[model samples]
Target: METVSGHRPTIIDVAKRAGVSKSTAARALAGASNISDSAREQVLRAADALGYTRNALAVGMRSGRSGMLGLVLPDIANPFWGEVARGAQDRAADADTSILIFSSNRCARKELMHLSTLMRARVDGAIINSVADSLDDLDRFGLPCILIGSSAERFPDTCSVGSDIVQGVGLGMDYLRSMGHERPALIVGQPTRLARARFLRVVHEHCVEHDIDPAVLLIENADYTVEGGRFAMQRLLARNHGLLCVFAANDLMALGAMSAVREAGLRCPEDVSILGFDGIQAGAFAWPGLTTIEKPARQIGAQAVAWLLDGNADAKPGTRVHLPCRLIERGSLANLCDASARRVGSVKG
Candidate 1:
């Protein structure tokens, strides 16, 4: 049956075209087991011919279960977040759902606004990577929500999915120690972020375990951008001339710090070694390449989707999932132990 003018094609139209009852066409389109193979094929073929498609929104409204998710991120421009968003989108597609993404740009008001919009849109659940605690709004709305990254730890009793920052920092520190780099400085996020304190704690613990006093260590904050990293590196350089290596909170900052080292008439790995976190692809192609701690960013995104949509009660709220991280060795870090051995041999000769 041809669709009437100014009207969208529906299952009725498909049924008329396929010479079947409306109920039979619906069951055939829905892949119901009761539908015969001949009827199913006819319904599918008729739907194709009439350009008929199921209205998921109508179906969801009638069933009171829309398969839509909301994802809110601090900065979508960052490559790390890009990978996370990609993973989430892919996973949502697999689950026959859609994701509505919003970038809050680390603004609390913006985050609230986006959350409100998601609620108004009737999304089933939300995945939020926040800058501040967002639990109160959650209680008010009574919607299922999950937090990602540092803010998740701050708010107890919320489901969160994130990579292990502690393990990542530990890998960087241990590798630095093995390379014989003692005076390692830190380029971290601003003090407002819970992540800054988290990184500081890990580095301080590492130094204490290695018998190095934490007070003497250099620590500066950056905006997780290249320019921010450059400025932070300049400040750290001004305070210390014997900087052997610097570990940045992310790869972009590390790349910027590397440029700052060169601007100071020094060479990477020769004068100042740099280590980065967040194992982005650009780190592999950087000049002298960047040694970084690889976070499972994609897994973080996908896992959040999985847990959010889980109908089972096993993944309870306030459950925090911390995935592991590892080190990616590259040329940015100098092997001072090897250089020291060569220096000793030359002096003896």
Candidate 2:
């Protein structure tokens, strides 16, 4: 079991040390179902003792798998997506697979290009976040693909994972209404984004069910960026100064809206209340901690990787998994139902 000079211990070394054949060592290390428990234990102990590591490239070549997964995101700069990437990376590492990440910058052409590049690279599978509207081209990629943060209905044959945007929006609206803010406006993301459409639809349905005034149900489209959020908030304020509360689709936009509120000589939770989505870490440190519907971005990312690794083997085509969102109460929202001096404080600058 002695290794050659300057050479790494190989499967042969593990086999000789464990008194098993090379094939047996490989099967034991791979945790193949056919390997006996006693033999597998012996091989594992010998490999640990000899410090033997299987060459992943060689293993992939034999198995016809690259042992790599691809992840495509709309914007890596967004902290929400950063958390997703972290989760995916951790999960991939656990399975002894590497990940190649591509940021599409929310461009359809770039997304397609990235997918093609991944295909050429021979990635075993892929997980796409916010896939483009039309998925006809994705069908030919010849890879096991999973979609995140987008509707499964749009891509019926692909496995999809994401938060229930409609439910998340409803939760935000109900919380705002409970706080006595009946006239709340929504700062939405681009119309091309599926989450945006789902959020708006749910908001409108909630309004209809509650008989809310149509005039107070204001909606403005943003680019899902901090700057975009600020611009959308400015527009909403200019159009309607009477809005007591505002909800932004994501935390970045919500933070931007808070900046705009301050520039307008208004105080959050005092002159106006603010609510946000995505539950990013930065939101917790905002001047008045942001009230938000917390989407488990990391968990979603991890689960997406798991689904891809499992190859959706037993699941039917077009399996959709929707993670629940929770409402996190923070300093940014004010209760309008409170009739004390604070209630007046909430209305005045």
Candidate 3:
């Protein structure tokens, strides 16, 4: 990546190219305020031609507030987290804030370290979807924070915005149960508060009340990754005979489970009905267009900001807020007595 002069183009060169002062170029490139539109366009074009990237660290330090928010998510590649990031960024921009993003990949120690780094930066605020398994692990954030997909009960003073896991799983169970899926398989999330463990508890309770076996096969925990979900589904299919439906904790795992079903020579909703949580865009585009629970991610993100900035003097330190999860029926489910079921029955006969 060499320039024609065999030297990297500097900020001065950008200013000269754009016919603007050094200060003006610097401000425009850093997204500073009060710069004329025409001048800003010139600087942007000049920077583009020079292939310039701003030194955010230096700029961030100069501005005490960083005008930035730190977002810590379990996995950036996951669509659900991607939506969270989208919502966070959209709202932060509205508030004239920037975002510094990081992915924990569901490691507790890594998440804590990231929080510490954000605190050190004196970030205006942090939006975290942490996988901390205990209160001690979550207590590390000594800054204004909003926890997405985590409970307010765990962190008293912190603001939380999460989809109702209990209700989401219950929606899936209710649909499956109504479809006559008496022997459904379950893919539990990794035993963290928001992702896996709570949903499992809700479904387990539903099973017991309905007089279904509380201990069914293919029930296991994994990181909320596609590969993890696929592996879990494979293990479940091998161990669970006569299973009619599979409920995944998240959309990624649900899509992975669909792959596993296809690999087992089964078709969705016909041979086996699969349901998932997190009504992300990718799920709607899935081959069978996954049936799932819709989480109001953008709404949650915006409202979380409202809560944190509410400036309520009497607001309790830790107030838990749970958003409702709405069931979305789609192409991935069918009654056990449907044509696919009859096909399986004929094969067995």
Candidate 4:
């Protein structure tokens, strides 16, 4: 057949070459069972000869599926979020779908704006790791969503996948206690009420279990940024210079806190032990590798996409999937008794 304007061959060209109707050619190319095998074979042969390619946009328009997923993160700059994004991207690729990621900068207003944009784009579904107080607004979007991390509990109507924060905190606190640190402080992330509250409750309960005075527990809030961690650590030092250890909510903050310790002429694991949550890769390269609770951030991200695309359709509202975290020992943490003995020996000399 003569080409029209010498442009790439279209499905229409394939239809004509195969001696079949346009609908039959389209259905055959799509592998629809209703089309006879003979017709399907003819369409396939014609498509190969004409070099005809299917248009994803046209397919989406006809099927009512955009084949796109949305990922909303509080802060993409953080390595933890990067790991999560990688996981989501890998999973989306496996499903032959695309992912569009948006960062909210941990702001409620910006998060709403991103969600609105995604809705206008008609994404098939979304996975949000939001710091916003309420997820009730999400219902208005009418899109399937899966909450990541603590936000999952805040919105019971959506499916969620995350590490068990309570268990993670407990594991960290218990490890510190075993190492001989009694007066350990906590440096938490931005003021997300539920997450902050859960971490504090776990810290307090851990203190009580160890017979450590709850009143002596020092708690400070940072923006979950490196600088925020540095400032929070400085403030903690200013208020209580005798603290033997500190636990940060995430790794970036932990690294910052360690920097603050060095600025104050103190050494990690020797002068003041440090522990962190979220086992981001950067932690392994820190001055004294961070001792942290390793959350399966990548796994969580991948699972969120799976739930949104394959599972959420049949899952009951408010379904939560909690993954476990493990403790990673590194140079940053030291046994309290060992630290004390060294200090006493130096004083005597």
| Candidate 3 lDDT, 1-349, residue by residue in tens | 3467887777888899999999999989877888999999999998998897665566777765566678888788878777777877787778776778899987878888888888887776677775676656555555567777754445666667787777777877888877777656777766644545577778779988888878863576766767777888788767646645778888888888888878877778667778888898888888899999888777776666665555321264556678888988888877765545443221010
* Residue 32 miss distance in model 3 (angstroms): 16
TM-score for predicted model 1 compared with the true structure: 0.91
- TM-score of every candidate: 0.91, 0.85, 0.74, 0.87
Q: Pairs clashing in candidate 2?
A: none
lDDT, candidate 2, 268-345, per-residue tens: 878778999999999999999999999989888899899888888226567888899999888998887877625514
The candidate scoring highest on TM-score is 1
- Per-residue C-alpha lDDT of model 4 across residues 1-349, encoded as one tens digit per residue: 3366787888889999999999999999887999999999999999998878788667877787778889999889999999999999999999988999999987889998989998877788889987677767776887788889777776776778999988899999888878777667889966645777888888888888878888977888997778989999888878754545889988989999999988988788677788999999999999899999999999998998888788573466778888999999988987756644543111010
- Global Cα lDDT for candidate 3: 0.75
**What TM value does model 3 have?**
0.74
After superposing candidate 4 on the true structure, give the runs of residues whose Cα lies further than 4 Å from its correct spot. Answer: 1-9, 14-21, 35-53, 311-314, 337-349
Clashes of each: 3, 0, 4, 0
Instruction: Output the TM-score of candidate 2.
Output: 0.85
Which pairs of residues collide in candidate 3?
A: 156-317, 156-318, 157-317, 157-318
Kindly give the stretch of ten consecutive residues in candidate 4 with the minimal lDDT sum.
Answer: 340-349
Candidate achieving higher TM-score, 1 or 3: 1
Can you give the lDDT of residue 295 in candidate 1?
91
After TM-score superposition, the amount by which residue 252's alpha carbon in candidate 4 deviates from its true location, in angstroms, is 0.7
By summed lDDT, the worst window of 10 consecutive residues in model 2 runs over 340-349
